[model samples]
Target: MRGLSVGLAGLAALGWAASALAQDVRPNVLVVLVDDAAFMDFGAYGGEARTPVIDALAARGALFVQHRTTPLCAPSRAMLLTGLDAHQAGVATIPEVIPPEHVGQPGYTLALEPGVMTMASRLQAVGYQTVMAGKWHLGSGPGDLPDAHGFERSFALDASGADNWEQKTYMPFYATAPWFEDGQPASLPDDFYSSEFLVDQLMDYLGETPGADRPFFAYLAFQAIHIPIQVDPAYTDRYVETYAEGWDVLRGQRRDRAAALGFIPEAAPLAPTPDRLRPWASLTADQRDLYTRSMAVNAGMLEAMDHHLGRLVDYLQAAGALENTVILVTSDNGPEPSHPVGEPGFRLWMALHDIEWRTETLGERGTTAFIGPEWAFAAASPFDLFKFYASDGGLRVPLIAAGPGIASGIRIDSPTSVADIAPTVMQLAGAEGAVADFTGRSLAEALSGGAPAVYGADDVIGFEVSGNAALIRGEWKLVRNLDPWGDGRWRLFNIALDPGETTDRSQSDPEMFTEMRAAYALWAADVGVLEMPDGYSVHRQISINALQRQLAQYGLLPGVFALVLLGGLGLGGYWLVRRMRRRRHP
Candidate 1:
């Protein structure tokens, strides 16, 4: 009896200590980010972009087709890091001015604001070794740098975004332009892809993982598929020939697939934006060749990256941490608005972008602008409009969660958002999700097939980029220009029914529009939407001046060429295998 008592007492004591320790131990989290791709682009979601590794994972995990996020790159990454919407972060617009003030308010800026909690800081507080490798678009100055925040080790762009995705970056945000590693002035080959370097470092880091017993939190943001897109020439031939169809044929095909998948009620009739194209017939074969190569380079980069993702998973499985570690793969945003900038990639292009009415594609002479609506509509998938707009097609992203507790091959219809990612991640790690509560809920139940729903009916979601805004409340969504110039431009859509915001019901149901607008006002007050500057904030000459200085610094001749170059695609990240990228049929 005495021995039994001692044994029981010891076991009970150990249990108590473990319970306390578990609270202090944060799970090793791996948040994988895919740049610029959409949910429909994946095999899991039912579209045709090939990502086998991600698909295999999804076959045994949960996929959120309705996951919403900002359609632009920097803002989306910022939102993902902080779990706060854009306004609170003070990153409403992609600044033509990389103001020094926007750097970390402390060392960890939650959208350039104080008191905001980052996933890194939150995980770090509970004993996580937060590490960020690749795109850290939140802010990158003194305290705002990844190191200043919770990330103990950091390898990312120098500022809110990167300069060049290829071996070089023209932007100051990089350690010193032309790409540097971990803030060190390192020299890389001109052809060395930033993504390859990022993945090499990530694998090197994962390669160092001693065991499943010691957990890590890794944020792998790969800046691929973003503009100046480049890839290993080995796979160049495959895509170069594929993209030769030019703009019109490609857009038509994308529409057909989107409709077949039921993402769109019916693919809206193809409406090419005039003054926006080089009419396929008008362009000589040589012109077509160059244009086609520009896009092929971008697509090939995605394909190559997808293959690398397969290898990364192979490494994980070989290391014996495959099933235990949690993996969530998603994109920062969907396809960018194919709107032409003056140049293929430059800052001056952005100033021209604010012109509001001049929708020109890049490659023109003085008037040369962006690629415009034709390509934007094709790539955005089942929705109208691309980056910077408050539309479903613009915000809806692909989300996949696989590992221990999550079920495979599931399509979760719940309207989740990027904010939900952190909580879902924390919950599945089997750790106490007790700290730094957020606007998101644990989707573990849904991922595991134990629960039918994820969040609640009242779970509201909002996204903003450069003043364009959108808010989701249940089935109805309101995408309006908020308060002041607040035309309420009231666009109401049953997102559940029309994931594509093509059919406008504002006129059909004025009452619903008003209700949604009112609801937005109330919600904005709660979340605190930043007050917009009254009157027309865009000044072409002044905007051009600010942009001019930025261009000169980057070695570009100012004006339209800069805009086109800057029109690069939505930036992507590195978080998971290839399967999470596929889109679905309706």
Candidate 2:
């Protein structure tokens, strides 16, 4: 007995040393990504949205007060998955992202380098299953897709933005061409809302995927509440009668309610809704009813999503995987404004920050949307601009992490970036040789209620709206306007107290302003996003010893069906594209 105890201690110490040296091991990681949502939409973050499911998560885990994602989806996603800044990966702008052909060569465009250890590969190496469902906007091609990079099982749409749920619709602006499901395209019509469809597919995959008995990495990127704005009849009914007055009335009410509920700061004034919208009283009765109904639908979807999330939690809890799984919930970018409420066009202008995005028309865009800035503004609190704006209002998002080893209900102020999620999950998983070329840090210490500061970032963050630039460092943030009729100049704010960014302190602090500007430029050139599929490689294979298998099998190889499923997807994709094109043009 004494000899056995000594041997076990030695083996444990050796394992610890090996893990320390291996550097990329972690627990079963689950990243729940919300689309185009700002930091304060949920009940946990003190917003009006009935996110009881997420609120439960917040109550059970640590919430990040100062968390941020890049302003757009593709670059932000790249940052998260690759653990590098947009500059380092070279995918700065959504449209400006370098093509796959332009990637991976020495001294060329930034793309997901094939050699780097992705979260999937790292987890796979340690015998964990890697599965991704929902949006895979980074790329759509063979190399660019999740399976090519490292994910063992995937069910995702490769396009960047879509609010429509009806499948197989064409999205030309997404850079990936059209989004698809499985190997074939889903025929999402004008009314086929993405939020509902995404949930359906995700639920299907979770219940049936491989390594269900093994430690797994589940990356669920939901398409809820993005564009082609949708509201199921159930949720739409709740607000059809209530929100007849348009955004001003709704914003006023939400602000009052939020402030009263202690969700908002006391002294901060409610930023008025934009001039582009019609007053509720002015719109016709049908228009008013549509607005209210639309809101109801949106809210209903939120509730439905919450219910489904509860289902997932119930599954984990029932399986006893609840204690072992570390769940992370966050958003892709800020709340995006799309279509006309009662208004005629997309209201991309800012209320106060003056960081207005150029007005665009969905007439040229692919889908239809009913609601406008009213719904988005109602969702985004304390922030100034819509999704594409570079300000904190456009970039800030809530990050909730809960599970065993996590301190519950704690608020962390460390400068955590979305890019940190991959490395953080790797650290949590205890997988060895997980990630390299990572520009982010693990929040493990902080999540566990320790205050070890996140390193490397010297208090600087960058954002871009087309060519417009915004930079945040310390308490101050700078926004450069791109509106030609205006100054096209820099405006700065102290974000700590002025979270809404109502006041500009740039004129007051010239030296500080200069420092921020220099920092912004330097960081922009120094860091970037890596577009995946550019020779990106995450070569992790599981060790039977690392898994908690249901059977006594020492080495569990993936079934042939799994191989055929992933292997045939790319070729099948090309065939589908050909078929669609033939049908369309011929």
Candidate 3:
């Protein structure tokens, strides 16, 4: 009887200690991820997008000046959530860009590898409620939804992107929009609009909580400013004349603002416009009108997303959970430059489906459009290139972290990766021990200005996506942009002094360049980065994948029939030509 009484007393004391610790720590975590936005698209970052909600967060938190992510969606999100390199997380590149030859390879699986720990799972193990809503592009197979990745409640879309106004796919890679609710296939409501519907679902999730004792991690990823840019008329009305000056002037203006705000050095030269980008003065009036309206819709979509975000902020405040919550806002990658409406195959597909794509209805429900490369270049002001390449513009993006412990109104200029987000969140939640698979360190101390540094000057970070490559160590960076946009020659630059990569110093400093090249070779081999075949490009790869899908659907009969019909037509044409020549000679 005496031993039983002592054991009961000991158990009671431990329970009390655990409860007390929970009460003393653990703030709710809210991560807001937007899609396909450039570094300066947010108002706080010096662009025309009216993101009041994000600007306020920047004012109240720390903005990371040199934050980088992969050049595309799946890889960036994989790193952000797992704190592992894109290859380490098993999403080396998006499924659209993965070559057929490398489809099932270790790093090209396009799914989270077994044993990879996600931030949600880590937090859930530590008594935090995990919830997610909006884009979840990681995977869509069994055991691949948000529930499998540690989210207890989720309403997610498992595609690169979807239509903002309906449950339809925005790209050719997917046949339908793959949406899942709590691990089961679900459908979107009839009244769907990307930003509004996402918040509505997330708010419903947050409101279902029983009490304030248990902290929650809510991840809201908006498909705003992505493909088929749709928004209310009011938001678009504000930017009708905003882009009239065109990309050339807008690029210079944004560069000046970045310098004034100390986002870039004043002496750093702006990158010369690429030869592919046509000047505004060379455009016809009709072309100018079409491009301007496209940009207007793009800006409007961004503001519409912010408007919906403000509603969520209001709800959290009304629930008395705003002040204690940690809010981190960032984009998956830089601006999207693909123009599907201009493609012959895409136009033919629309025609076959009886879909109408008109200029006046560009931002409407049935129409699909994109800003293409010219606007994407301007969106990434002062930087060299846009998304889908390994340039600074493609990798560089804005990151703002605001919460209970972080300093307000400050900018951290240190180099950080998207992978750092997971460890940083775990550190803030006091759930570090639950995570044992992180390849990134916490940036909490660095953001707070209380620690020395997270990365050493000698540490090398190598990045690759679809064979585009870059390696950075301290202030030096080595890059190789494949054929179309570059000469495929390795170039070195002092990025700290020239964020625009205006000068290549590989010829001037041979020894350092050699060392960095050797380091990149080792890193690539370790990460399972495979070589791209000769004459490969992401655009051509996408076409190949699309054609493959069509062939699989129709089988071998259609191809054979078409080939025979073409051969007969060729023979008939040759006979007709020969007869005409004989008659002329006679």
> Whose lDDT is greatest here?
3
* Candidate 1: tens digits of C-alpha lDDT, residues 353-384: 33211212221112212223445555665665
What TM-score does structure 2 among the candidates reach? 0.73
The residue-by-residue lDDT of candidate 2 on 202-247, one tens digit each, is 4445444345445667777877656544544555455445555566
Q: What is the TM-score of each candidate against the true structure?
A: 0.76, 0.73, 0.90
Clash number by candidate, in order: 67, 52, 0
* Alpha-carbon runs more than 4 Å astray in model 3: 1-24, 210-213, 353-356, 553-586
Off by over 4 Å in 1: 1-27, 46-48, 97-112, 160-167, 170-191, 209-213, 262-282, 338-373, 432-434, 481-488, 535-586
Measured over all alpha carbons after superposition, the RMSD of each candidate to the real structure, in angstroms, is 11.9, 15.0, 9.5
Residue by residue across 111-166, what tens digits does model 3's lDDT show? Answer: 89898878998888888878899888887688988999999889999988888877
Alpha-carbon lDDT, every model: 0.57, 0.59, 0.80
Rank by lDDT (best first): 3, 2, 1
Which stretches of candidate 2 lie above 4 Å from their native place? Answer: 1-26, 96-117, 162-165, 170-213, 253-264, 269-282, 340-367, 452-458, 484-487, 528-586
lDDT at 398, model 1? 82
Steric clash pairs (candidate 3)? none
